[model samples]
Target: MKAQTANGFPSVQLVVVKNGRMIKNSAYGYISTVDDFGEPLMQKNKKPITKETLFDLASNTKMYTVNFALQKLISEEKISIYDKVQDFFPDFKDKKKALFKGKSDITVEDLLKHQAGFPAGAQYYVNKKITQKKKTDKRQNKEIVLELICNTPLIYSPRTEVLYSDIDYMLLGLIIEKVTGLPLDKYTEENLYKPLNLSSICYEPLKKGFTKEDITATEIRAVKRTKDEKFKDIKYMPVHGTVHDPEAYNAMDQVSGHAGLFANAESIAVLAQVMLNGGGYGNIKLFDSSVLNLFTSQGNFFSQAGLGWRRQGLNNSYAWAFSQLASADTIGHTGWTGTLTLIDPKEDLIIIIFTSAKNTPALFGRNLRGKYEGDFYLAKNYGAVTTLIYSAFKNYDNAMLDQMLIELAVGRNELINMIPEIYDNEGSRKDLTAIMESIKEQSKQSAILRKFLKSEKAAAILAEIQSRNSKKSLAKKQAEGQSK
Candidate 1:
């Protein structure tokens, strides 16, 4: 908690559940110390964040708004995942749709899997003229935004590859409205949230009667301006009790399919458990277990993606959030605003970490390598906390230890190399060596160890560890020589 606060994120709420039981629920840090303009205010004036403090779920909203709603609609036979997008919105077949040549064939399933080939999303809020009009009447502006999406060119042929796009879910939200004759929020609230009795989950929470004190602050920025110019005399203000995504805030006014849901850890845990229970919480079954399976099962095209949820990918593996202990069947999602939820049905585990990292000065963007990077606090804190949680659950049994050894062995050299970069003290180095020696002693009596000792994996682990240690010794010698 202290490390996260020092890294700039002001608050963090965590909840962990196993086998439908709440194992842990805790909160840390204040909601905000700096005001809207990034100026520090009196500590007494700021509210300490609690388990109930609502956070902007950001893209996490898609799981509820699109995935859950579609499950209900499909169960009711009102719509099919295979339904063509042009079937509901005929505009795609019109003359203006020529730009998106293959869009007419894009299926609801394609959009759900984010394989619809739409550009990520357009910043419709960047248009000053449209911004002024949107401020006056957001409903009208939403229609304008939809039209803009319709007219935008496809970046690739439909379903050629996975390219996650907010436009796809935005269109799905519009489809929900078209099918149910209710706004996305209303439909979701009535169908999913209310039925499950998740009171803290909703869109436009302030309008729903949640006060600013109940919501964590996000982003301190001057009044929004057009891409072509700046806003004259506009003063910076903290974004509080409002959606933080630019398109969701400026264009949709805190209600959108891809973003704009606000929730606390308790409400989030209920939803996760519902999914884990095979689409029911107690007696309330929103949809059949089969429907839940259809959404969570990996698609034929992308093994790392289900209909709307992200499965454990090889590169961005579950270890990124749930640690190496997570099962292959685990599915989860991470929000741009420092929120993460992981559900492992095999292990009957659910972990939820919610934080308002965007409230800090670190903004989301890319690095020179073009890999997306931001909010070092979120990355570091989440990694450390998850490691601690998994370690706490660690069993000393041979099977579990063998599994842990396999993972550690895969990256043993890299892990040793990271020690110098992470710890500056000789005491820490000695501690690490002692821990390694303890593991080595345990491995001597294990059957799995004897079987794998001559195997390629074990040999690789030993060779890497030796190579890295030698490199470290040489580097230390060179540094000492330079000093002399």
Candidate 2:
């Protein structure tokens, strides 16, 4: 955690839960290393960060808010995943058949899977032309944004490809409101969080009694300007104690379904644990196990796509966000602000890593598309942390497992996922197919590979894997009443 803080982020909070208990919860660093104007601050002057400090959930809001509501609603028989977009909103009907032929056929499942064909984003907060009126009223502004989203043409046909978008969840928030006649925040609080006794997950925390010092700031010098050049003058500045997402702040006024939620580490751990428990915590039951199973289950058509969660598919996989040590059934989501939540039902484990990675020196345009060079933000480094966590579970050596899997006789898919040199090169993919077809007669491998494939050595690795997955251990743990 200290290394990650030194890398770029001012603060990082990590929470791990196992067997429905928070086994680890820790926070390090400060509230902000820089001021609201993006000016650097002296280390001693900065306020201390704590596990209680609220951090913006960013796109993680989609899973907890919109997806959580969808699960409950489906359990209540209020809505089905197969329902059409036109059923809820009149604007999604075939009004522009010539321009967008199949817009209306988009189902609730398509939106959840991010296959509804909407572009990754749209600037609903700002008008495109110079002569347009600037919206001030929050409610009226939301209406304008909704109309714009519905009128905008999709990038492709429904179920074409999984292009993650905020527009999908924005419409979902409206669907919740349409069904319950309550605001998104209010509905989730009453129906989901409050009942589960999870308080820290909420939108508009500044209005909900949280002070600026109580929440970790997402960005410094964060003046959100128009994406369209014509309205560059229209921008909001001095971001602090407010959402860093533009569409959430300027469009829905920090209460949208996509990215307006803020939460603390402990609260997030509880919510994740509830999912691990099959949607029940203590005496409360939010939904049945079937609803949880259905959402987390991998997509039939798109193997990588879960209903709303991210599925950890096998080799030649589309989703590799979770740890390689994570079981194939693991599901999770990440946020733009460098937040991650992973749930592995197979391990009865949940891991949360939240860092204020955006609270660094600002970057200008074109560079916005560039990657963060920090070690904490890189998948390779933090993914190693996840692997270490699994290693700590019963003191098993996963690094050895990974090394062996890479060195010897791995199947095609496992080899592809294990080696980036093979996975990233298009030609290497074709070469691998040929080599695997004639493995025994292929070119000579290193002596280490030959040694590891011996009967005793190979059997040791398999025994470790089988022991980690042993039903006898699971039965003993279950009999113990599941302690931390």
TM-score of every prediction relative to native: 0.76, 0.76
1-484 in candidate 2: lDDT tens per residue?
5534543447778898887778899997778877655667887688988889998989899988898888889888999899887888888754545454577788888889888888889878765521154555334656777777778787787776778888999988888888888889999889888887777778999898889899887666555543432323544333567788888887786788888889987887777887888887898877778999999888756665688787777651423456677887788788887788888888999989887766754433342332332222332234655765776785765456445334433443344456644232322233233222223222244444445445573454445334544755787789886654
Off by over 4 Å in 1: 6-8, 42-44, 94-100, 132-139, 222-233, 313-318, 363-374, 378-381, 396-484
TM-score computed on alpha carbons, candidate 2: 0.76
CA error at residue 117 for candidate 1, angstroms: 1.3
Clashing pairs in 1: 36-237, 36-238
Write down the lDDT of every candidate, Cα atoms only.
0.73, 0.71
lDDT, candidate 1, 357-439, per-residue tens: 66654323232121111244433236545655666566546666665555544443344456533332222223233334444
**Full-model lDDT, candidate 1:** 0.73
